[model samples]
Target: MSDWAYSDVVPWWPYVFILLGGWLPTDVWRYIGVVSASRIDETGEAATIARTIATSLVAAVIAQLVFYPSGALADIPTWVRVVALCIGFAAYQLSRRKILAGIFAAEIVIGIWALAPGLG
Candidate 1:
């Protein structure tokens, strides 16, 4: 933003380095997951529990974003988000558990809602 934050103060490659620094931890987990999977049983109860927990965590995040969102999402009516999510869930279940169908339906609904002139 200023000369004080230039190459002399913050260095020329700080942004590049910072980007790599943030990615390192994610890569570490990816490598660990690959290594661990080879050693663990795929059908084991612990693995099942871990997968369930991960799914629950993701679902919780999706619910929170739909119910109590922030930033631009906070601008959209709560009712819209709720209705979209409900449609998505029903689509997901009705499509014989097809995840992509649910995602597509939900996204299409949101896009249509966002495009409606009266929304503003």
Candidate 2:
């Protein structure tokens, strides 16, 4: 981790730079999303695609963190994650599509599930 390490040097065939190159692609998409979002509406095709991407990304992250999870999430049962998602979905519906309610309800489900006799 020392600053004087030779690996920090900007060599021509630099692997260090390549390793850090991933940030550009991610940032490009973020900037594109921001710019394009301004031109789209709640029901436009762009919005639809954006929503689809957002939903897919969220689902993928949750699924990965549930099924192939590490850290604290690895301790919970699969049923708990599924139940939490369902509760969030139900909240999404009940709240008249309010996203915040869905998020809060999912957290509530996690808390309740954690407090349950088996999950703790």
Clashing pairs in 1: none
Instruction: Give the number of the best model, judged by TM-score.
Output: 1
**Displacement of the residue 82 alpha carbon in candidate 1, Å:** 1.1
Question: Which segments of candidate 2 are over 4 A away from where they belong?
Answer: 1-51
**Which lDDT tens digits does candidate 2 get at residues 1-120?**
656855456455365466568777788889998988777788988778978999999989978976887988877778887788889989999999999998899899899987777665
Candidate 1 Cα misplacement greater than 4 A, ranges: 1-6, 115-120
**Which 10-residue window in model 1 sums to the lowest lDDT?**
1-10
Worst 10 residues of 2 by lDDT: 7-16
Maximum-lDDT candidate: 1
What's the lDDT for all of these models? 0.87, 0.82
Q: What's the CA error at residue 28 for candidate 1, in Å?
A: 2.2
- Candidate 1, residues 28-58, lDDT tens digits: the string is 9999998888888879999999999999999
